[model samples]
Target: MQNRPDLPHSAINPQLVWTGFMAMCVGMFMAILDVQVVATSLPTIQSALDIDPDQMSWIQTAYLIAEVVAIPLTGFLTRFLTMRWLFVTSLTLFVIASAGCATSSSFGGLVSWRVLQGFSGGTLIPSVFSAVFILFPKERQAVATTVAGVLAVLAPTVGPIVGGWLTETYSWHWLFLINVLPGIAAALVALRSLPREDINTSELRNLDGLSLVLMAVSLASLELALKEAPTSGWISVYIVTLLCLSTASGCAFVWRSLHRTRPLVDLDNFRDRNFLTGSILSFVLGIGLFGSVYLMPVFLAFVRGHNALEIGMTMLVTGTAQLVTAPIAVALEKRVDARLLSAAGFTVFAIGIAMSGFQDPRSDYDAMFWPQVVRGAAIMFCLLPPTRLALGRLSPDKVPDASGLFNLMRNLGGAIGIALIDTIIYTRSEPIGRTLLARLQAGDTDAATFIGVPLQAIADHKGALDQKTMAMLDPLLQTAATVQALNEAWIVMAVLTGCAILCLPFARPVAPAE
Candidate 1:
């Protein structure tokens, strides 16, 4: 057998290598897809389970909290179990948890299964990213990363539509059930195709119990705080306590990690210039990616009165454009400097997001089409370049930990970005609504026109609408205000994404693989 510099020495058969990797990608896709699928169909799930509206959020929140707690631990898990078994073990559990979720008859049971699903699913993401660098040589890394990156980003794009159709055409139970067969096949293929390795059970002895506790407490608290902060005032006592606990525990964990010879998570990876810059870009990209996906559905459903399926179909343009542009992105990534490609991606992405910010209350599919296309085309560019920038320069031994930290930033960015978006929508909507109402009362024809109430109607009413008419107009006023507030949130995402480009100057260019 001959060894080539462009392939890992262990990769004697490229076909088997790719098959194994793609199998892992399937697990990653299902894991990421579950989040979006469950999210869009929450109302349906809530109705079926008879869950209290306030507590219904726990369905998603539990998963998020558990997932956040698990993401950084992936580096240690990989080292302990080895990549082959780590992936198989996680995916197997994810499958079991999905089945549990599908069969649960109560809220508590559903949430319990979700926690397990989230924890197991969380490990799949970093494991796949780490494999890109570990399994392939630099010359082939871009293509490998593109395959993983597309699935990672694509899952979220397609999730809403898949979820909507499933829940509408079949039932909410199918959401979790859909993962079962694919998960089983992926697990089987990954087990057979991935290289076998010895698991180091001895790594268990060196694990810091207290540090693990602190890390779990820190991430869990932070996720909880973010989830509640948008609705509950950020300074509310419960939210403040959660923030304080998260900060205290997080600092202690970091301190312990830096001082240890072999820590569970390597916080020092951020000190690398390219890795740090790449991580920042990943974080901001999360804001735009998750935030944009979130904003469109809210607008379509709340303001436009579209159902889950309709909203999903409307959002499909972004996914379509992403698929269309993926090859072009891969081709460019191999030839262009990563930093330059990243700059161009972010610039176009910001323009795309900014375009959505100008929509009036009546904005629908036609209004949103180009923006989705622009953002979609830019998604691969956003994902592939920053990925290479972050992990491309790191040594193989350091890559697993670095991948965890790099991917962690993006998830954190999403958690925080959504919270920020919600806060904007919640806090600003009322004030704007009040202002709009006052204008309408003062016979402002523009205010009437904005909410789709005819100018003639307002003029005919002579600034003295009956109570019944005012009641009917109230919901319209609120919807219009929310639309305005949503536009404001879109601009915030655009600005945040645009500002990500500023960090590019700090990242050293990754030289082409020889």
Candidate 2:
């Protein structure tokens, strides 16, 4: 195993390590929160900015694309920049970008700022993990992971609530502006507590610029293809061209990485069965994570007629549950076979997703609670143990590359999942909408009128429906349509989870450490 010369031993003081860990947690929270917080505020953004449906996705896409491009560079970047300096600089960039987002006067400006925010935010998770491992002893890695995990899980859960409250009570801008305070505080703490170390000038020169360009192009092109595939028609030339470009660049990335001495991604790591399996499982788990994240708020807002705040409060259950269960998951990983635990986690996740498929227009908030709790537990089971088991087998030298690759898979999976589910929803809703419209337009005497308006009138007035009228009848229609769409999506996710279950049989069982 190769030692990382850049890591200074003096940084491992218990109190300083604890302080730095807490600071990293703060940064991680802001990064993850910013990712999802905009979800609940999307409606507001759309309304205020008059963003087109096609372009609205770019709000999220901009962030995702930037993160995907930045993830693979973490290993190289750590070799040049000391972790303390990197942490402070990244946090500062994030804070400035957030402020820019809050103050942006146009949609284009907002998207631009979000891209900058994503660029800085992308370095956070890997950096946090690296800092924790470097600053704490091996035995305390679990505690560090727990702290980070809790923040990571809690961010998505609370994102909606926080974004909702800000969007509802104040304005959408506050969603971004709120980060400034925490960002500054985190940066200060990180700068003060995190130990500075020397850079590896030799490794610094090995940064693969061409590989980075190829990766960025590939991911960006793929994202565009996915976003446009549903609306642009699957056979559209733009989609085809983008897909081809993405495929070619992706192939080049792999070929170059494998054949080159100083490859950008170090493709050889995939030859490690543990790393390969872990990356695959991470990808699947990412589909579940991002898919549910995207689906839930859309469900609550469109189907249940809940305001953003209400939706946020509803999601709080999942976050709270994850916090409670994470420590237990770590304990279980220490005691039981991780392979079995991961399989059980996937099974539970599938069951929870399947339960989600059962929700109807009449389902109440209470009925939604247990499924979320189940998912929370499932996420802990799936994410924690598998992560431990996967990285546990790697030599320390390979850990950084393995971590980068693992995170990249998860991020890529998230992008693919969002694209798949969004496409499914768009495609499924059209025929259903058309059919429902036809029934409403039939003008049968027995047909139930919505808000005393004939079905035909309601369909025609979709674009012009007043808030008052929409408030009255939207829930029923949205509930029916959304439930069907979500059910189909969840079933697809369940199948993906099942694939993870099949892979679990191959997970190497580790004997307890003597």
Candidate 3:
């Protein structure tokens, strides 16, 4: 075995390591939070920048595509540059990019800055995940993972509220400006505290340039294809071409990786049964986690006519529940079989998703509270176990690459899950709206009630309603249809999450790594 240059336990300083670890967590949190934050305030950004509605989605897509490409490259970068240098450099660039984003006056300028932000921010997740194993000993790893996992899931949960408050109180520029101070402080702390090792420059000389290109092409094209698939029909030539490019490039990258002694991404990580099953579970959890987050805001803003802050305030229940349950989850993780814990977590989470699926047009804060609580309470279990199952058995030197692949699964799952949710909403809403409209035309009072029109307004008029009255009701009908469509998307994700449990049996039991 090669003698990796990890810091020895005897030389460790408890205070500095903890400080550095916390700094890395902050950086990771900021990165993950930016996605949801921007999502919540995108309308404000679009209006302020005078961006066309058709081009508005590019702001999010460019960031995401850049992120997916950067994730798998973390392992190689870590090896070449060392964790400390990689993190500090990435965070510094991220902060600069955030500032750039805030000052941009045009759509192209904002998108360019966002791409830089995404690539830099994308490295933070796997870096923190890798730090867990590198920085902590066996007994402390579970606690470390629990802390990291809590923050990882918590950021997205709280993002909408944060974004909403900032947009309402200040302006859209504050959204990116918020990261500047904290990011700088984290970079300084990490530079001083994180362990340093001699850089391996030889890795750069041996780097497979072709494999790198193949991966970038595959991931970027796939992300673009997913972004367009809902708006453009799946059978459309542009989408089909992108999908083919992604598939062919992905296959070539995998083959080349397996053949190399030092591949950019370690494809061999998937050979471990526990890791493989855990990655699958991570992907499914992403669907439920990211999909649920996307579903709630849409339901609130469009269906219930809530503003950004109100949407955030209403969904705050989930983050509150997660915080309350963190200690209990941490305790259970130390005593429980991870597979069983994961199974229980996914089951409870599925129930939460399904509960929201049954909601009507009238569902509001009170109606959503318990479901959010259920899902939030289950989040730690969902994250902690799969993380341990996947990376626990790997060697010290291998953890970085393995961590990249592990984290990438969840992000990929999220991208695909959001795309699917949008497809269901876009294609099904018009048809569903027409059906409800037909029922109302036939004098079905139930349809009127579901669409939230007054009994007195439509009851006597019945089939003889005037054009003005019908026009007034059109928006309401459309909203109700969207709500139902959102519910269907929720149910689909719930079923997908529930089926993830059956795969749990395949994961080998994980004991804490030595």
lDDT for model 2, on a 0 to 1 scale?
A: 0.76
Give the range of the ten consecutive residues with the poorest summed lDDT in model 3.
1-10
Model 2 Cα lDDT, one tens digit per residue, 41-73: 787898888888768878887987887777777
> Which of candidates 1 and 2 reaches a greater TM-score?
1
User: Candidate 3: lDDT of 69?
Assistant: 92
Q: List the residue pairs that clash in candidate 3.
A: none
Write one digit per residue (lDDT tens) for candidate 3, span 1-514.
1223445755688788889999999999999999989999998999999999999999999899999999999999998889988999999999999999999999999999999999999999999988888888767788889889988998988899899999989999999999999999999999999887777798899899999999999999999998899999888999999999999999999999999998999989899999898899899998999999889988898888898788888888998999898888778878888898899999999999999997779999999999999998898889988888888878888889989988899999998999999999999999999998888877888888888988778777876778898899988888889888998999999999999999988888876332
> On a 0 to 100 scale, what is the lDDT of residue 332 in model 3?
82
Give the TM-score (vs. native) of candidate 3. Answer: 0.96
Tell me the whole-model lDDT of each prediction, alpha carbons only: 0.90, 0.76, 0.90
The model with the greater TM-score, 2 or 3, is 3
lDDT of 2 at 299: 81
